[model samples]
Every structure is written in C-alpha cells, then in structure tokens.
Target: MTGQFQKSSMYMEHNPGIVENGDFRKNLDDDGRPKRTGTWMTASAHIITAVIGSGVLSLAWAIAQLGWVAGPAVLMAFSFITYFTSTLLADCYRSPDPVHGKRNYTYMDVVRANLGGRKVQLCGLAQYGNLIGVTIGYTITASISMVAVKRSNCFHKHGHHVKCRTSNNPFMIIFACIQILLSQIPNFHKLSWLSIIAAVMSFAYSSIGLGLSVAKVIAGPHARTTLTGGTVGIDVSASDKVWKTFQAIGDIAFAYAYSTVLVEIQDTLKSPPAENKAMKRATSIGIATTTVFYVLCGCVGYAAFGNDAPGNFLTGFGFYEPFWLVDLANICIAIHLIGAYQVFCQPIFGFVESQCAKRWPESKFINSEHAVNLPFHGAYCFNSFRLVWRTAYVVMTAILAMLFPFFNDFLGLLGAASFWPLTVYFPIEMYIARTKMPRFSFTWTWMKILSWACLVISLVSAAAAIQGLATDVKKYKPFQTEQ
Candidate 1:
C-alpha cells in the first residue's frame, strides 16, 4: 500500500493533469486541455476506421428487414443522431469550467468528471465489456472473412468436408496470434497510420460489394421494379416484421456506434483544451465518408438480394461473377480488422495497465511511464506492462473466439449492450447535465426525452439479443473441425 502511494505520487508529479482523486488540477489552461496537435485528416481517418466495423456488412440485411423506406430512414436517423451526440462529447472533453478545464482523456474520465458516483463503476463495467467484446469481435470477424475466402478457393474447391481439420479454427487462432503482436502499440494516438490503411481497406471492400450488387440488380429480370421475392413486399405486414426491424435498429446502431472511443481519439489531437472545433470537423467528415458507403452498400445489397439478404452480405453474396473480387474484399476485411482490434484494445490496455500499476507498484513488469525501452538495433521503444497485458488479453479473446465462433451473434449482442448507452444515452445526458440546461425547458425536455427513449430502445434490443443467444449456444461446438 505504501509503495502504491509512492508510485501514484510519482505518476501525479509527472502527469499533473491527473490528480490523486482522479480529477484534474485547475492549474491547466483555461479550458482544461493539453497540447492542441492532431490534424483533421488523420482524425477523420481514425473515426472512419472506427465507425465502419464489421457491422456495415450487415446493413444490407438490416435494410431488407426494415424495408426500403424504414431502412434508409433508420440509417439517416442514426447518422444524424450519432453526429450530434459526438459533438456533445467533443464539447464535454473540457472540464467543468470551459475556460479553466483540463481535457478528460478517457471515456471513464469524462464520466468521472461530470457524473461522479457509483455511476463510475457501472460505466467501467459497461465500457470494459464493450471494449473487450470489440477485440474478440474483431477476431471473430477476421477469421470468418478469411475462412470465407479460403473455403471458396481451397477447402470447398478441394472437395473436402466443410467441417474438416482445416477449417476456420486455424485461421481464427492465427489471427489471435497476430492481434497479440498488433496490441503492442503503446497508445491510441499512435494508431494513425494503421487507421489510414484501415480506412482505405474499408472503402475498398465496401465499394466492391456495392458495385457487384449493383451489377446483379441490373442484370436480373425486373431490375428496375420493386420485387421482394415474397418474404418482404409492399404490404410489410410480415409475421416477424416488427421484431426484425428492432433487430435492424441494433445493427444500424452498431454501425453508427463509435462514440465510445471518440474522446480517446480526440485526445490524440494537439490543441490546448483539445479544441472542439477540430473534433466537430473530424466528426462531420468521418460520418460523411461512412454515410456515403453505407448508403451505397446497403441499397445495392438490399436491391440485389432483397429479403434473402443474409445478416452479412459477404458470406451471403455467394460465388458470383468476378470471383477474385470476393477474395480481395475478404482479404481487405481481414487486414482492416487487424488494425481495428488494436484501436479498441489499446484503451483496454490503458485500463488494465492502470489497475496493474495500482496493484503491483514495485514489480518491474509494471512501470509508471506507460512506456518501455526496446533496444531494437537502436531506440525503438515498447512497454513491458503493455507486452504482458496485451498478450494475455489477446489469448483470452482468442480462446473465446475458438469456443463460440458466431460472428453476427456476438456482434449483435455487444452492439445491443453498448450501442445505446455509449452512443446515444450517455452523451446527451452528460451534455444536458454539464451545460445546466433547465430541466423543464423545451430543448432540455426534448433532448432528455430522446435520451431516455434511446436508453429504453437499447434495453429492449439487449433483451432480444440475449434471448437469441440460447440458440447460438446450442449450435456452438468447441474444437469441432467443422462449424
């Protein structure tokens, strides 16, 4: 305990922005901000990469379930809602006094700063679950993407059993090892280069999916007409329509759900008080970029496959013309997830490393600097604590992925759990409280109502998702050569 205090004091000395009570000292510049540094382009790239997760692949199916009108409506609604909430988060980055606040670096920091109480613990639980789930989700997504491409070209091509020894298990395990290595990145800000690559990969694959779907729609009979292959038609009174639309709400929310990491990404910028101006601009551009792709991919995918669209169009697209395009797109997905797994996991390591430092103050394995000296032919640095935490973290996720390899199921569950709270509820509620808006005012009334509505929606979606998990569990078989 004494040594822990000493280390804590040391950390506080070196990082004056953080205090013993986990609050910022008032000695910071007017609007509690550090260096104002990151560029808008780089920030946009990071947001784009973070926002366009594997969820976008499900947008086509989401559209099919929501029907043409409701589908596009929900997408646009989520887009605008997320953008607004993101700006609120950007404004919240500053401390109590806008003129005399230090930036809140992490999501928990924001929660602790504004709405302090037992809510902190609740926030921690939800945030950690969401982040870890994201890492595991990435592994699950990558393995499926790779397996789809490989099976198309190798396993199925060779006339082997679909559940043979060489199935998705090996690829999943390999990517888990890869994540262990990528998770070495010291902090969230350092992921700029990888985010750029990830953004391009997202664009590349999404564009291909859109283009092919458009081609199929054009080539098919009654291409210009509204034909729904029976399941989804103009009447829209299908048996499970309402439930499926709620499910689609979860998917759209998932695709638009990047708010959890928005503040962390903002901290990477180099401005005093981490200027909201830059963050707002980045948020706008990021949403704009993703919206373009989302609309194209979702529309084409729904039009081409109609109600038959699977939860993930990549797997559902089947072996169509220009087969190599599918392989290339899948390859891009694998690479993008590699970078994304690191982006989300970096913050988890931040949480873990902080706890470890608090726990084992004297151990050399855990350092105060959040940094390490890797003498790689010169001065390439690494964090020893990071090395340990990330390795174990990846291994745990890998094991889980191996045990239950349900890609969309896990995605839906995590999205339902975190999307509403992180993306919609917290941001607006925090904004209302911090700004001291009148509880009875028209603006405050509407915003508060919206926030509560979203919270309720999230709760319902979570219940539905959990109820479906029983089916997934029944189907999963660990270590079985075939799925």
Candidate 2:
C-alpha cells in the first residue's frame, strides 16, 4: 500500500460527482435490482469471506510441515503477494482514462482485454477450476468441522472418548443441499450481509481457536520453554522433506488464494471512492484482518500441538478440555463455510449462465435485469436446469469429500493447480502486459523474475501435492484419522 502502489484517486477532493454519482446507475443488473452496493465495509467483508475460509484450519498443520520458521515466514510472504496482486487486479478493473470507462465485471474479461489471444480461454479454465475447487473444499471443511464438534461434545458429556456415529459424507451433502438453495441469489452484491456475517464468524472461530491454543500451551508445565526453539520440532525424520516443503508452499498459497474472484468482487463496489482505491483499501483491510488471526492461529496452535497438530486447529483442541469453546468454534466454521460456498459459487454460476445465455438467448434466461425465467422446456425446465448443473456440482464435490476429507492435501492440490495459473501467474503477467514496461526494462525484468519464481513454485508444489495424494490413497481409509 506504499510507493507506486499508491495512485492518487480521482476523487481527492470532496467531489459530489464521485460520491453522489456513485455506482447508483452503473451497478444495476439486467433486472434492475441494483447490482453494486459495495462500500469499503462490504468489500472487505467479501474479501475476508473469500480469503479466510477453512484455510486457517490448516495453518497449524502447515506450520508443522514447514516447522515454525518457514511456516510463518511463508505465510507473511503470501500476504504481501496477495496484497500486491490484488492491487494490480484492482487497477485493472477499469480501462485507461481515454477509452470508454467501464469495470471488467469478470476475470476473463480482464484477461481478454489486456492479454488477448488464447489467454482468455485459458483464464476461463483456470478460474472455473479454482472456483469449483473452492466450493468443494468449503463443503468438505464444513462437514469436518460439524462432525468434530459433534464428536467433541459426545466425549465431553460422557467423560469418555465417544466415537460419534455421525457420518462425514452425509453432512457434506446436507450442506450442499443448503448451498443449492442459498446460491440461487443472482448477484454478488446481494450477499453483502452474508459475507459480512461470514467474516464475523471467521474472526470468531479464529479468535476462539487462538484462545484455546494459548490456554492449552500455557497450562502445560514447561510453557515458556515450549516456544519456538529454532530446530525444536523440525522433523528431519520425515519421509518426504522435499515434497513436504512444496506441500507447505501449496498450503500457504491456498491460504492466500482469493485472486480468481477479485474482479467480480471489484464489480460489486458502487464506484464512489473509485473502485481501485476502494478495492485497495478493502484488500488491505481484509488481508490485514485475516493475517492477524492467521498468525495467532498458526503460532499458538503449533505451539500447543507441535508435530502432532491436526490439520484443522479447532479439531485439535480435544474432546475434553474447552469443549464448549471448541463446539462454538466449529459451529462458526460450518456456518461460515455455507456463506463462503455461496460467495465463490456466484462467479461460477454467472460464468455458466452467461455462456448459456449467449448460446441460447431464447431459453428465457435473464429476460430482465432482475430475474431469469427458464421455460419448462419439457414441463420442468427450471427443475431440469437446477438439477442438471448446480445440484451436480454439489453432489460431485460431496462424493469427493467422502473420498478425500483431508483439508491440507485438498488445499495443496487446489492452490498448486488452480491458484498457480489463476492467482499468481495471471496477475503478474497481466500487470506486466497492462503497464507496457518494456520486457527487458529494470521494472519489467524484476516483475518477470518474480513471475518465473511464482511459476516454478507453483509447479513444484503441484508435483509434491500429487505425490502426497498417490502415497495417501491406500493409507487414508475414509475419515480414519479423527483419532
């Protein structure tokens, strides 16, 4: 948020044109429900919901894989990278001053406008993958969080380790059913309340997690000595150090991977304080907010559990002690993921529906700015549309959740494959192309160098994640590690 990143906003003065003439008109959807209502508050809320979902659960586990040093260091590093790239994305929301001014509404639109060629098609693929991955990831997380709470409650109530009979797949599917109903909301802006509530929930769970970790670690006899001792918990005996390192990188990347929907988020802003400025402020606030919670969650949770930390921090708090807090935290997590699932899915739904509209405009979709009415092509068109695609996405992900409930591994794969291209590579390349800073020039050179580094990191991370999956397939055995 310093140096060249700080561009003077057009509304430096108290210009009524900028404030009064805000997104009131520019933001209306085809159905006239007023699409853009994002202020700094709502925008930051969306960002928090997008960036902080379930990823915080793995911060401790990731720290264990990377150890104290590399883990927190990499976390902070991703924070800076996310902020920078988000700003680059914010800057790209609108065209150059002279050209007809309009926001890029979609991620692919930005790429198509700036990079051109097959880049647009490529971006579309990456974006959809990232979006779908996140939706599935959230569902998986919600199920785990809910089940953990149930098990912990059973244990605490009976003063025994009660093996809760609640199944994981059913819970995931249940949440997906909820998502199918909630995700019917047409525009991203409409969910501002949902995102805000989710953000508050995120902070609640994360803070509770941090509180429980501190209490646990401090309650132990050798509390002060348990702090970061350079090589204290460094697992040199780990079977796959090289792969684990990259897996840790992918985990960090996933924790910070919210770039894919940034444009759609930018579109939600009502364009008063200027979308770029508002976006930058919102990004900074959101990242800063999440970073505080992330650092605390990662640091304290790792300190409390060390090498044995569960992938989900709340799950590690145990069934006996702090049972109430743990239950509350997990409940918050489950509720929060519901909203996050919807937030991420809006972009995917839009992409699919818009494409369908272009292909079959006569299908009675978006006939008005406010709503869409698909004809019952065979006496049940709406039901057919709902079942065929949206429901399938939830079911497909729920089935995957049944198979691979591991949060960190899922994060590794998603971050490496999807965020690699969609989040890291595209933003850097787009910025370089948009700025036209002469390929070999000093500024451009460094940007290119960073882009290459990010690319290599992404590829290595993906390979490590794939390797981990190959090894785990036989051993995982469907939700067996709850112990």
Candidate 3:
C-alpha cells in the first residue's frame, strides 16, 4: 500500500490536476482533467439527442413501405439490436477489464485499443465520414422544416391548390449560420445543456407528430394500406417495391445510428458506479424511450396516411389543418436539429483541431487560444483555426445539402453506409477481441452470423438508396428544389 501510494504521488507530480482520493482512485479522472459530473441521466440525454434526430421524422415513410406487421416488427428488431450492441460497446469503454481498465477518450481510441492497424483507419474513416453525412442531412432537414413553416402559412392563407413554392437554399443558409455560432462551443464535454434541450425538442416534435397522426386517423378516410407493403401493380412496380423496401430498412437503420459516438458519450460519465454500468442503463432507457416514440409515430402516421405517407410527416405537410400547431412542430424540429448538428459534428471538429495542433504545434493560428469577452456572457476562449475551419465545414455541408436535398434518399444512403460498419461490425469485433471469446464457439459463430446478416442488409439498402437518388437527380435541379 505504501508503494502504491508512492507511485500515485509520483504520477500526481506530473499530472498535477489529478489527485488521489481515499479510495486510491483520483478525484479528477485518470486523465489530468476536471472531474466528470455526468450521470446516467446526462448520458441518456446525449444518446437521445444523437439518436432521435432528423432520421426519426422519416420513420413514417419507412413503415409505409414495410406495411403493418413487418413495419413494427422491424422497428422493434432494430431497437433490440441497437440496445444489445450498445451494451457490448459500453463494456468496451474501458480496456481489458470493463469496470476498471484504462480509459479511452474517443471512439477511435476504443477501436485502436482493441483492433489496431488498418482496422483503426477504417473505423476512423467510417465514423468521421458518417458524422459528416449526418451533419449534411441535418442541414437539409432543418431547412425543410423552416421552409415547411413558410409553406404551411402560405397554404393556410391561400387555397391548397396555390403553388406555395419556397426555395430551400435560403433556409439552408440560415441553418448554417446558426450552426456556425454553436460550433464554437468547444467539445462534447460542454454540450450537456444543449443535448438536454435538443432531447426535449425531439420529444416535443415527435409527440406533436403522434398527436396529429392520431387525430387524422380519428377524423376520416385514410390512404390505402396493405398487409405486406406497396402493392406490386397498383402502388408501384415489383422492382420499385423491392427498392423501396430496402430503402425503408435503411431509414430505420439510420434512425438507430448513434453507436458511432457511444464511446464519446461514455467518456463523459463520472465513475464510482462505473461508466459502463451507467452507460448500459442509459442505453437501455434511451433506446426504449425512442423506440416507443418511433412505434407510435411510424405506425400511427402510417395508419393515417398509409402507403402514401410523406418522407417527413411534419415537414411533408401531412397535418395541414392545424397550421399553427404544424408551424410550432416544424419550429421545434428546426431547433432540435440545431443542437443535434453540434452533437455529431463537434467530434469531427475536435478531431481535426487536435490533429492540426499536433502537426503544427508552433503555428500560432492553430495553437493560440484568445479570451474574447462578450457583453453578458463571460470571457470565451477563441481559436482562429477553429472559427475558420468550423465555419467552412458548416458552409460546405450547407452547400451539399442545397445541391442534394432528396431527404429520404439521403437519409437511407447515410444509414446504409454507417449502420453495419460503425453500429454493428466494429462494436461486435471490439467486444469479441476484448472478451477474447474462443473462435468458432457457439457465441463466436452467432456473433459473426449477426454481423454478416447486417452487412447484407446494409448492401441492399445502399443499392436501393443509390437507385432512389439517381431517380430523384433526374427529376430535380440542384439549388432549385422548391416546395
């Protein structure tokens, strides 16, 4: 015990910020940083903020493609898979021993610890690329919500037949501006309040959508719904139905694609109860909550609009009667996405900034932090490179969103690209490696089988999404997608 104390004292000499408590664990974390205050509740807020994003708004359209039985079944299945895999990932937040191993600060760090070399690079590419795609998708979705408010008002004032065409470019620009300001919030550690607000907004908009759908279902004639899916000849051709079904699967996958950032969220947790234990509980709660909302929104919306359900029920003008309520819901969606955009993109921002600082340590532009005083708020730490890079990143995504505003196609494609590799394959592989599960054993075989099945689903979803994008590209002109 004396020797251990001596070693800990020596370590503290170097890491001054960390001090050992009576339990021998540091008051501050293992890293020489401030003590983490995150509880299971904050972790749940982060997960909900990340998971219940713009993707949830598309679930109605996804269910429409799969019909009554298959739709709800698929939602429940994805929820279970996400929760299970997330628990496995939670165990991996620490190293060899889940409860007491060394900390991994980021998702890439976790991958590097378990599966090194080429796999690490692949994981980084998939994880960061998916984040970028998510930001772009959020930009498009937020703009759509903004446009929906204007269009809804226009429809209410004029007749339904009048063309209330509004260009999404302006709204996209406005969303980008808001993100530019929020992007300066530094890192994930400081985003708890924003995440909480976003979580509430997610629930609000989802509830509004659910209430509207239930009202529609009660009010009168609903669109035609089928048992299996879209009718072959009547609703769509056989080939189209196949593609739509696959795309719907992709949409569902995207809605559940928060695993990419799971480790980052876990890293925020204060440990005495252990980060893994807290994260597992948070994952269960977050996934269960979102799943309930998803089922209610998707199934009820499908019942209201059936096979013709809009890609985004709120923004798609499905509930046009209560114009004020529709406006409020869209406003909530836009606000929710504002925070969600920062949640996903901040990781990428941190990654780039860290790399730049490391590679160019002496470059004042990258390394220097300035204290800029605001009127009411306290002095803020500002970095020139951060401002320039993050603004450019937001601008680039905004431009891309304007160029390709095919909402459903983009969501499906992003989901298909990310679902297997980040959400399933990496977590499973890392878990297997960490556990050192014997090869070819029953457990090992089944895990591999699950991974392979998800891969197949991802591939088909990607193909379908590509087909849809191609079809939409032929119909709509870039930068001129008016609704």
Judged by TM-score, which candidate is best? 3
Give residue 249's lDDT in candidate 1 (0 to 100).
Answer: 77
Best-to-worst TM-score order: 3, 1, 2
Better of 1 and 3 by lDDT: 3
lDDT of candidate model 2 versus the reference: 0.73
Model 1 agreement with the true structure over 174-273: per-residue lDDT tens digits = 9988877777666676689999999999988888788888888888853332333225355356645666767777778778888778888887776542
Clashes of each: 17, 4, 0
Best by lDDT: 3
Question: Alpha-carbon error at 124 in model 1, in Å?
Answer: 1.4
Instruction: Report lDDT per candidate.
Output: 0.74, 0.73, 0.84
RMSD of each: 5.2, 8.9, 5.5
| CA deviation > 4 Å runs, candidate 2 | 1-35, 98-100, 160-162, 223-238, 317-319, 365-389, 403-411, 478-483
TM-score of every prediction relative to native: 0.86, 0.84, 0.92
The residue-level lDDT of candidate 2 at 396 comes to: 80
Candidate 3 — which pairs collide?
Answer: none
